[model samples]
Target: MFDLDLWREIFQSINKNKTRALLSGFTVAFAIMLFTILFGIANGLENTFEKFFIRTAENAITVRFGTTSKPYKGLKIGRQVRPSNKDLDYLEKEFGEDIQYMSPKISRNYQVSYKKQKGGYTVTGVAPDYQYIEKAEIKNGRFLSLKDVNNKEKICVIGRLVEEDLYLKESAVGKYIDLEGVQYKVVGVYSDGGGDSQERVIYLPYTTIQRLYLGKDDIGDISLTYNPNLTVDQALALVEEMTIKLKNRFDVAPNDQRGVRIGNQVLTAKKRLDNISSGLGALIPIIGFGTLIAGILGISNIMIFIVKERTKEIGIRKALGASPKSIVSIILLESILITTITGYLGLLIGVGILESIGSSLERYFITDPSVSSSLLFSATIVLIIAGTIAGFVPAKKASKIKPIIALRNG
Candidate 1:
C-alpha cells in the first residue's frame, strides 16, 4: 500500500508546476493561520475579563436598589428605595448556612487626610465579611472586627492607590486618617489590581459609615455568597427563596413600596460573562470554517485543472490495468499530503505569534486567542478530510476517462 513509485510520481507532478503548488499551499496556510490568530485573541480577551471579575469574587453576589422603570402602586417611577440593617440581619439568619460571607455597603464621596497629606475618595461602609466576599488581601495590619462594627469604632482601610497618594509609603497602617474632618485609624490596605485603579476608597465599619456619615441606619445594599455544596442553579434557587422571605420581612408590598431592594453580581454579571464566553467559543469556529471552505475551493479548482492536464496519462494507466480505486486513492492522497503539511505549518506559525503576542493581547481582551491541543488535532483531521473531498470529483473524472478519446486529446 505504501508504494515508493506512487510517492515519486506525486513529487514529480508537484515539481513540474512548483509555483502553482507553492501558491496553493500558501492559500491553505494563510487561511489556517488567520483562523488561529483570531481564535487565540478571543481566548485571551475572555481570560483577562474573567480574571478581573474573579478578584471581585466569583461566588459572591452584589445588590443594588434604584428607581424602577415603571410606577409601583401610586408612587412615581423616580421614587427612592433604600435598605436597612434589620433587613440584612434577617437575610443572614435565614440563609446563613447557605452562605460563605455577607456584607452591607454604603458609599459616599468624601476627602481623607493623614498628617498633612490629603486625598479625595469614595468611602464605603462594610462588615468584616467584606474581606472574604470581596476576595480582599490586606497588605498591612488587619480588617474591621465585630467590636468595631458594634461599638461603631472609627477605624478604616485604604485602597492601594489611596495609600500611595496620601501616605507616600505603606507605613500608614496603625496611623489615624481624618475622614470628613473626623479622625479614623487606618487598619489595612488592599490592591486595586482589578484595573479599577482602586477608586481611592476608605472602608469603615458598616455602623460607623451609617451613623457618622450618612446620619441614618439605612444601607445601600447587601452582598452575599452561597455555599459550593450546591450547583449554581440550586444555590441561586435557595437565595431567591431567601430573597422573597427577606422582602416579606421588610414589608415590601407587591409594588415594592416600603420595601428594600436586593441584587446579585454573581447571578447577573457572572451569568452574562458565561453567555459571552460560550458565544465566542461558538463564533470563532464558524469564522475558521469559513476560511477552510475558501481553501477547499482553491484546492478543488487546482485539482480539476490537474485532472484536465493529466487525462491522457490517467487513461493510458487505466488501459494498462490500473484500477479505479488506485486512481482515486493516488489523487486523494496527494491532496491530503499537501493540505496536511501546509495546514500544520500554518498552525505552528499561528501558535508562535500567539505565544509572542498573547500577554499584550490578554491585556487588551477578556479571553485567550490560542487553540487547544485537542482542537489542533481536530483541525488537522479536518484539513486532511477537506483535501480528500477536494480531489474526489477530479479523481472520479479521471477514473471514467476513455482511453481512445484521451489519447486523441494528448
Candidate 2:
C-alpha cells in the first residue's frame, strides 16, 4: 500500500531531526564498512596462500641429501650422503603402489649457445616422469621419453623463457643447442607456473647427464608425487616409514635428521590451511560483535532519545485522533529506510576502496580483496532487520503514552 500522507509525516520528522538521523545512520554505516573491508582482506590473504602453493604439484615430496649429523655403526659424522639410481629403483621396488611419479634430478649450470646467442642456464638431467612431477606444460613438442633415457640420447627440453632468450621468437624444437661444447637437439619447449626462474632452464635424459657430466649414476636429489588417493595422514605416515627405511639402508642413526631430508607438500599444506582457518575463525566473531554493538546499543539508544524528544508531538497527534498504528509505522519505517540506505552506501564505499588498492597490497600478501555480492546483501538485510526491531521497542512505548501525561511531561 501506497501511503503518501504517512510517508510525508515520516519524512517531515526525519528532516526536522537531521542530526539525530545522521548520527544513527553513521553508526550502522561505519560498522558495515569495517565488516566488508576486513572480510575482503581475509579473502585476499587466502588467495595469496593458494597462489604460492599451486606452483608445484600438490602431492609432491622431495628427498635431498646432506652430510650426516651423527655417527652410526662404524661410519663417522660429517660423511656426505649421496643418493643414486639404485636408490630410485629400490624405492620403486619397495613401495611401488604408494608412488605415482618419480624422477632423479642432476642439475648443473652450463654455458648454452644457439647460433651465437649465449646464456648461462641450469641444465637438469631428468627421467620422463619428471614432467608430471614438475607440472611442466609442453608448449611445442614432447618431453623426454623412456627411449631417450635408455639410449642416453643427447636430446633436451627447453623452458619457454629459454626458447625466448636464445631462439628470438623462433621455435627451439628440432634445433640443436650447444651445452658447454656438446650439441643437444631440442625435443620440446615447456612452461611452468613457478614463473621466469623455472622457465629459464633446460632438461635432458638422466642417463645422458650421468654419462656426460659425472660419468656415474649419482643424482643430486629425488622428486616424486605420492598416490593422489592417499589421505594427508596416510601420506605423512608413508614419508615417515620411507625415511626410517632409507636411514637404515645407509647405516645412518635412526634419529639423524640431516642424513636424508624429506620435504612433504602434504605436511606443508596442512599447516598452512590450519593457520588460515584459525585466523579466519578468530576474525569472524570480532566483526560480528562490532556490528551487533552498533545495532543493539547504538540504534536502540538513539531511538529512545528520539521518542523522548517527540513526546509532546506524539501526544498532540494522539489528541488529534491519530491511531497507535500510525505512530508506530512512522518511527519504524524511518529506522528501516535509514539503516538500509546507509548500510548499502557503506558496502559500496568499501568495495570501491578494495578495487582501487588491491593491486598495491600484493607486498602485504593481499590479493583481489573484495566481498561477495551475497555477503553484502546479507549484511544490509541484517542491518535493516536490526533497525526495525530497535525502533519497535520505543515506538510501542510511544504508542501507549497518555496524551495528558505526555503533554505534562513535555
Candidate 3:
C-alpha cells in the first residue's frame, strides 16, 4: 500500500545521515556502471573479430595442390600435383548437394588497357559463383552470369581501381577494355573494401580464359563455400574426404600432407568464434558478480550502522506497540529505493557513453557497443533483490531490541 508518512520518515532519515547514504548509493552505482561498460567492450571486441570473417564465406574451403612428399606406386617423391577442370567436374558431379557455391580459378597478371591508359593488373578467370564467394559488392551494373560462362562471352567485371584508372570519371560499364590485346566488354564495377591491392583485379568467365587466354584446362585453385546448415565438424569431415579422393585420383600417397591441401576457413572461423564466446561468457559473470558482492557488502555495512543509530527510536516504537513486520519493511524499502535509483542512473550513464563513442570506434571495427534492454531490466531486478537481502539482517536486529536495553544503550 502507498504510505506518504512512511516515505517522509524515510526521507528524513536519509537527510539525517546524508554522507553515509550517499556513500552506500555510490557503491551500487559504481558497480552497475562498471558492469555496463565491460559488457559493451566485450561485445565490441566480438564485433571486431567478426569483420575478419565477413570478407570471405564463413564456411568456405579452398583447395590447392602441392608437391607430393611421399612416393607412391614406385614413383619418386616431389612430384607436383595440380588440379584441372576434370577434377572440378568430378567433384561437382559427386558432391553437388553438399556444395553451396564452387569456383575453379586461374589468375595471371596481364597488361590491361583502355585507349592509351595501360596498367599491369591481375586478371582472374572465375565462374559465376566466384562473385558470391569473394563477396564482391557491385558498385555498378551486374556480376558475371551463367550465360556469359556457358557461351564464353568476352565480358569482364572490373574493380573500382581499374575503373578509376581506365575510365576515370566515365562509367566503365558497357565499355570495352583490352586485356592482353583481347577486348572484353566491362559488365560491372565492384569493390571489396580490402584496399587498393584487392581493387586492382579483373574477373572474366573461366571458360573464356581456358579456351582463349590460357589455352589449357588446368586450374590454379578451387574454392568452394558449403551449405550453411553444415557444422564445422561436418565441413571438416567433408574436406578430409575430398582430400582422400583427390589424392587417390592423382596417384598421390594417402598420407601425403603436401599432395592435397584443403584450406578450410570454416574451422578457423569457428575456433576464433568459440574463443570469443568462451572469453566473454567466463569474463562477464566474474566481473559482474564481484561488483555485485562489493555493492551488497557496502549496503549491508551501512544498514548495520543505521540500525545501531536508530536503536532508541526503534525501542520507542516497540513500546508504542509497533509490529516487527512494519519495522523490517521500513528498512527494506529504504535499501531498495537507494539501490534502484542509483542502479538506474548508472545504466543510463553507461549506455550514453557507449552510444556517444560507438561511431568513432568503427575504424577499429568496434561498431554498436551496446547491451540488450532485457539485460538492463534484469540488472534492475537483481539490484532490488540484493538490497532487500542486505537490509534483512539489520532490520531483524532492530526489531529484536528490548525497550529497556535500547533506551539504556542510547
Candidate 4:
C-alpha cells in the first residue's frame, strides 16, 4: 500500500504547478469545511429544542383551570371552574391505567427571609412526581420523598437562586428559612436549568400547601403524562377527550375552549420536532450536495488543465512502451491524493472549531455542536467518487494523445 516511487512522482507533478494545485485543493477544503460546520449547527439547533422542552416530559399534558365562557346544564356563564384534589382522585379512578405520571401544582407568592436577606419568591407546592416533570437536579441533600408529602412535612427544596439569596456561601440544606411567617427546613437545593427566574422558586409538598395555604381540597393546576407510545394524533385526541370530561364534570359547555385550558406540551413539542426534522431533512442534502458538486467541478477543471500541460510527458511515456492503464492510474492517484489531503484538513479544522466553542453557545440556545460519523463517512465516499471521475475523464483524454502530435505541439 505504501508506494514510495508513486508518491514521489505525484509530488513532482503537484510541485510543477503548485499555484494551480493549491487553489484547486483550497476549493475542496473550503467546501468540506462549510459542510461540517453547517451540519454541526443543525445538530445544535435540534439540541436547543430538546433543552427548551426539557421542563416537562416530551409527551406531557398539563391542565389549568379557567373561567366558564359558555353556560351549560343551567350553570351561569362567567363562573370560575376550579380543579381540586377531588378532581385528581376522580381522574385516577377513571383513567389511572392510561396515565403515565401525574402531579398537582399550587403556587403562592410570599416574601421569604433569612437573617435580613428578604425577597419575594414564588413558593410552589408539588407532588413527588413533579420532580420528573421539572427534570429537577438536586445539587445537595435530596428531593422530597412521598413520605414527606404524606406526613405533610414542612421541609422545602430551594432553588439555586434562592439558596444564593438566602444563604450566600453557606449551604441551604438543613437551614431554616421563613416563608412569610411560617418556618420551613430546607431539605434540598435544586436547579431546573431555567435561569434566574425559574431559580427564584421553592418547592414544597402539595399536601402541606393545600392544608395550610389553601383548603385541604384545593388544587391550582394538574400536570399529567399519558402513554408515550401513543402517536401525535392519538395523544391530541386523548387531550381533547380529557378536556371535555373535565369541562362536563365542572358543568362547563363542551364547545367552550376557554372554560378549560389544556397545555398539550407533547403535541406542541411533537409538531415542532416534526417540523425541524423535515426542515433539516430537506435542507442539509441540498446544501451538502451543491457544495460537493462545486468541489468536484473544481477538481475536474484542474485535472483537465494538468492533463493538457502534461501532454508531451504522457506521449514520451507512451512512446517508451508505457501502457494507457499506467497513465490512467498515475493521474487517478494524483487526484485522490490532493482531494483526500485537503478534505481531511478541512474536516479537522471545522470539528476543532466546534469543539473549542464548547458549551458557551448554550447561552444562545446552541449546545454541544457536533457532526455525526455517518455524515463524515458519506462525505469521504463523495470525495473518492469525485476524485475518480475528475481523474478518469482527463486520463482518458491524455491516453488518446498521439506521440507525433504531442511532440510537435510541445
Candidate 5:
C-alpha cells in the first residue's frame, strides 16, 4: 500500500515550507510533551505516598491526643489530652480481631549526650510490634523486645542522628548514651532516613521510661493497623467509632479532656495525589485535542491554498483520467506523512527533555516521574487521524473542479 510517488511529494512539499511546517509540528509536539511529563510527575507523587503508607497493615489507624484549645462541657481551655496505658489496653480488647497491630509511642525531643559529643534527637518509646507496624529498619543489633518492655529494661535503640552525634567516630551498637542523667544501653540502631510520615526516632521501652525515670505511664500516641483496602467512608466510620468508644470509656469529652485523636491524616495524602492525578489525567486529553485541532486546521488551510495555486495542474490531472479518490488520497498521504514524521520527532525531543529535567525537578517536590508508552501511542494515533482528515476535505474540493473552469481561472 506504500506509494513511492506519494511519499516523494509529501517530502517535497514539507521541504518547500520547512520552517513553517516545522514550527506547526512543534506546536503539536509541545502540547503532548507537556501532558506526558505532568502525568508522569503526578504518578510519581502517588507512588511516593503509596510506598510510605501502603507497605504496612491495610486498616492501620494512629491515635494522638493533643491539647484542646477550648473548654468543652465545663472543662478548662487548653487542656492537655494525654493517653494512658489503660486506653491502650481498652482499645486492644475492643478492636481485637479488627486490628492487626497495636503499638504505643512516647516521643520527646532530647539532647542525647555522651560527654563531649552531644546532639538533639527524638527519643521514642516503642515495643517489638513497632517494627512491624511502622516498618522500622535496623542497621545493627535489634529493636526493643517484649522482655525489655515487661522488665522495664533501660536499653535504647539509636537513630542515625544519634549515631552521628554520640558515636559518629565509632559504631553505635553496644554504645551508652545519656537521657537527662538516665544512662541506657544502646542495643540497636535504626536506619529510617527521614520521611513525611516517619521521623528519625530513637526508641526505648515504655516501662523503661516509666520505671527508670519515675515518670508517669502516659504514652504519647497509639498506632493501630487495619486493612487498607477499605473505602474512604468505611475507614472514616471505623476510626470515628473507635474514637467515641475510647472517649466514653475514659469519662472524657470526645472533643476535650481524656481526649484521643484517631485516623491516618496521611491516608488523606491519597486525596491530594488523587486530585492532581485525576485533574492532570483529564487535562492531558484537552491539550492533546487542542493541538490536534490546530494541526488539522493548519494542514487543511495549507492544502487548500496549495490546491488553489495548482488549479491548472489539478484540471490537467482530472482530464487525464485521475479518479476523485486518487486525488484525495494523494493529498491525504502527503499530509499524514509530514505529520507522522515531525510529530514523532517532536515527541522524542519532548520526552528527552522530560527525562532530562525530571530528577532535577523532582527534588523540590515531585518524586520519581516517567511517561507511559500507552499515552504516547494514543497521541501519535490522534495526530495521524487529524492529518488524514485535514487533507481529505481540501483534496475532495480540488477533485470536484471542472477542467474547463480550472483551466480558465489559471
Candidate 6:
C-alpha cells in the first residue's frame, strides 16, 4: 500500500539532515560509477582481441621455408630449404581428410599500370582455395578458378584498394592491366578485413607465376585451412605432424626449427583469448571488492549513525503511539529512495563517459566500452536491495529500544 503520510515523514526527516543524506548517496554513487567504468574497459579489451584475430580464418595455417640450421643426410647447414608445388601435392595426398582448403603462394613486387595510372603493388600468385584461406570477399565477378591455374591463364583478381588506386572510380573486373610489360586480365575485385595493406595487392594463378618467374614448379609458401570440425588440440597436432614430415622429406634434422616454420592461427588465437579471459577474471573481483564493499560498508555505518542521532525523535514518536513497524518503514523507504536515484545517476555518467571516449581509445586497443542494458538493470536492483538491508538492521535496533532509554541516551 502507498502511504502518503509515511512518505511525507521520510521526506521531512531527509530535508532536516540534507548533508548526511547527500554523503550517503555520494558513497553509493561513487562505488557504482567505478564499477561500471572498470567493467566497460574490460569489455573493450575483449572486443579488441576478437577483432584482431577475426581478420583471418581461425583454422588457417601457413608453412614457410628458411635455411636449414642443422645438417642431415650429408646436406650441409645453411642450405636453403625451399617448398615447391610437389610439397603442396604431398600434403594434400597425405592429410586429405584433415585438410579443407590448400593453396601455394608465390609473391613478387611489380609495377602495374591501368590506362595512364601507374603504381607499385605486390602480385601474389595463389590457387583457387586461397580465396577461403585469406577470407577475401568477392564484391564483383569471381575469384581465381581451377581452369585459370590448370591452363596457366594470364588472369588476376584485384583487391578493393587496387581498384581504387589505379582504376579510380572504374571497376577493375574484366579489364586488362599491365604488370611490367605483360598484361593480365582482372577477373575479380575483392575486399579483406585485414585493412588496406591486404587490400592493396593483386592475386594471380600460382602456376602462372611459377612458369613466368621461376621457370620451374617452385612456390614461396603453402597455406591451408584445417577441417572446421577439428578441435583446437587436433588442429595443432596436425600442424606439428605435418611439420615433422616436411622436415624429414627435405633431409633436414628433426630438431631443426628454422627449416620448417608452420604457424597455426587457431593456436595463436586460443592462447591470446585464454590470456585475456584469465586477466578479466582476476580484474573483476578486485574492482568489485574495492568499490562495492567500500560503498556497502560506508552506507551501513551511516545508517547506524543516523539511527543514533534520531534517538530522541524515535522516543517521542513511540510516546505518541507510533508502532515499531511504522518506525522501521520510514528509515527503510528513505534509504531505498536515495540509493536507487544515486545509483542510476552514477550508471548514466559512467556509460556516457564510455560512449564519448570510445573512438579515442581504439588506439589503445579498447573498442566499444559500455555496459549492456541488462547488466545496468541488475546493478540498480542490487543497489536497492543493498540499501534496504543496510537500513533494516539499524531501523530494527532503533525500534527495539525502550522510549525511556532512548530519551536518556539522546
TM-score of each: 0.64, 0.81, 0.81, 0.85, 0.70, 0.84
Candidate with the larger lDDT of 4 and 6: 6
Task: Give the alpha-carbon lDDT of every model.
Answer: 0.76, 0.88, 0.84, 0.84, 0.72, 0.88
Per-residue accuracy of model 3 over 118-231 as CA lDDT, tens digit each: 999999999989888888899999999999988999999999999999888899999999988799999999998567887889999998999997788878889888887877
**Clash number for model 1?**
17
lDDT of 1 by residue, 1-410 (tens): 67999999888877886876787688778877887887777777677657756656677766666554455455565556677888777777877788788888888888778778886788889999988877677888888899999999988988878888888955878888888789888888886555554536778998997888678898887887778676667766876676567545544454552344445545666667778878987997789788777877877787787777778888888889989888887777778778888989998998998888776664565355667878776766776787777789878877887778877776
TM-score of 2: 0.81
Q: Tell me how far the alpha carbon of residue 57 in candidate 3 is from the true structure, in angstroms, after superposition.
A: 1.3
Question: Which pairs clash (backbone N, Cα, C closer than 3 Å) in model 4?
Answer: none
What TM-score does structure 5 among the candidates reach?
A: 0.70
At residue 258, candidate 5 shows an lDDT of: 32
Q: lDDT by residue for model 2 over 27-72, one digit each (tens)?
A: 8888778778878888888787767666678788998888999999
Could you tell me the lDDT of residue 37 within candidate 5? 61
> lDDT of candidate 4 vs native?
0.84
Error of 3 at 181 (Å): 2.3
1-410 in candidate 6: lDDT tens per residue? Answer: 88898888888988999998999899888888888888898888878777866667877888888899988888899999888888888998999999999999888999999999999999999999999989999999999999999999999999999999999999888899999999999999999998999999899999999888789988988988999898777888998899889988888798888888798655767766767778886987588657777888888988888888988989988988999999998889999999998999888888888989999999988999877889777777877788889999988999988999889999
Best by TM-score: 4
Between candidates 2 and 6, which one is better according to TM-score? 6
